[model samples]
Target: MENCKQEFEEVDVVFSKTKHLTKEECTKLQLQDSRLVSEFQASKLEIDAKKNWDLFYKRNETRFFKDRRWTTREFKELVNGGKSCSGKVLMEIGCGVGNLIFPLLEEEPNIFVHACDLSPRAIEFVKNHPSFSSDKINAFVCDITTDEITRQLELSCVDVVTLIFVLSAIHPQKFAICLENIYKLLKPGGIVLFRDYGLYDMAQLRFKAGHKISENFYMRQDGTRSYYFSIEFLRDLFTGAGFNIICNDYVHRRTINKKENLDVPRIFVQGKFQKPS
Candidate 1:
């Protein structure tokens, strides 16, 4: 009777690796074997970043990226009590085609939005959008890493600055300068809602070795740059810029493709930092 009970209690289990790639396979699949770009070429790309972005907009027009439908759900502060709280001022840095801004305006029509992008063509698209209103949105082309940004918007007048997937496109060295510029424009207690690619995300892993511009930064064939962020680095960056970190965390998920037999892990870092009141 004891032996029979023991046999009945035994269980069989199966275990599988979360990711199937071996070290060599991963290296072969991800790393590019082509020669790295020369310093001169890299410099040219950096200087021509704006031109490249203009070309990008001209190529893809308004159909490249999907509208961010999750902003209201993720950031309730941007909308109070189901509708846009009146008189709130928002600046969407790197506002590409008014994706985020337009949706927010649809929900909260009373808020004023200041939208800027490095690409003039992108700003043009925003201005031409059917929903755009001159009174509701102030759209312009300004590179935040330069002094030109001040000419487009006044300092200390903005209530919230949204940096959605924008900072990663700028050089890491200029990150602090961009943040400082935003800080000068934010009102006391104003918040910056941030989201960007996180370190070791599938996008970064997909970069060829030669495309690597710097540590965790890569240049795509299209001439744009992308940088992956770590939670610690991002927290330090905002805090060092004089903002208090209210929240910082990684959003991770695994995407599976049955046809390709691929399981890709995507990581994004989302944070909210506020200027001291």
Candidate 2:
């Protein structure tokens, strides 16, 4: 067991060192490191990533997501006498570290949230968090694909379900399955708001030519997986899963700091779908 642990630590170190590689350095590492190449080849990296995500939140939840201090201004505006959230339930599918969960709670004190994720570590982190509360924010460890969370728990259907930076991590084919399940739990006229990576973001372009795992999906050196998505596919998935499209917008943003050009590319695709009231 000790030998196995040492070997695992060695592999982890290699993965960490490879993360900051320049696009050129990335190519060289891919070429020179046969182990890394084989790890990429096996395609079991996604399963390996479940552990990686566990380690990630365990080690860096506070520094990485900074969930404790996050608040969404738009959510604040919307809920503080805004049109949508006066007397509605809200759910965030992958409420990692409770960034969106706690913020949305702070925004509209009256609304309740049923937040879930597949990672038990993530759920535990949220549950034990200083600001966490069972009444305002109910965090659960659940894999929506296999788990009958909504029915088993007897939590009522939600008014709006938020999927923030989450759909990009799932197997692309399972996207529909996820959407269908969420739709089943939403009241008529409920919305699914998504904020995630768009195509050609920095993460997508990091792929070595051989690292491609079927279209826009790729495995990073750290065993974490990512998928880049487009607006058209997102719209189709929601509509096919029994949602009527109300609003779909693509937003482009930039940062302004003197002497530095920060053209960080992001796609904000907001969708408001109703179940035919």
Candidate 3:
């Protein structure tokens, strides 16, 4: 029957309303009454973005974000879509403390990696990491929105580019420029693997109106910023950047920590886009 088929049909994500952390104080405030960040403060946050992220690593080096071992599984393109991975060039944008970089090397040792971040401290952490090697990785400091990665890397040389949880920190208006830079670094047929916050994610919903910098973008308490993306927006972004979208969809998962008594739903949009061969 139609009803039975619908019930048992495979689904990519089970849609749910945005959730709230049960004990978060922000939930108590009404959006209308809460104040948005002032223009001066917003500008200061943007200007001081690097300093804030550096301080973030200074305060919690190699502790804030854990090793992302799930990257390979989530983005098959990282491992060459099950093909040979030998001699491939991988560039991880916003590679904080080499968390993802080191683990990726351990899992697939044949590929070379170029890891860069806006925070010099973060890049230092990567260079100082025991697994880091000049032969294996070239870690550097770069603010992709303004800096030219081509100076360090030959244009169109990279086979895969990973933008994981990085773009959300940048101003939305600069997204096109940022993607353009990334596009120039990839081989003609190379792919970009992207995963970032999704619109109405719990983290987005957790912010009080006072933290808002713009629609769907907010300033965190620590001075860093976050922007949530809709699937439609991502499609438009990548396609408009001249990429052929392989897949783009919302991924929903829950972060569970029994010791902390935490179970929070998280939403993210992930996609793979390739340049024309």
Best by lDDT: 3
Q: Please give the TM-score that candidate 1 achieves against the real structure.
A: 0.86
Residues 85-190 of candidate 3 have per-residue lDDT tens digits of 9999999999999988898888888999999999999999998998889999999999899747877788998999999999999999999999999999999999
List TM-scores for all candidates, in order: 0.86, 0.76, 0.87
Best by TM-score: 3
lDDT per prediction?
A: 0.84, 0.63, 0.85
lDDT of 1 by residue, 93-193 (tens): 99989899998888888899999999999999999999999999999999999978877778999999999999999989999999999999999999999
Q: For model 3, give the 10-residue run with minimal summed lDDT.
A: 1-10
Error of 1 at 271 (Å): 0.3
- Scored by lDDT, model 1 comes in at 0.84
Which one wins by lDDT: 2 or 3? 3
Model 2 stretches astray by more than 4 angstroms = 1-43, 66-87, 154-156
Sorted by lDDT, highest first, which candidate order results? 3, 1, 2
**lDDT at 96, model 2:** 75
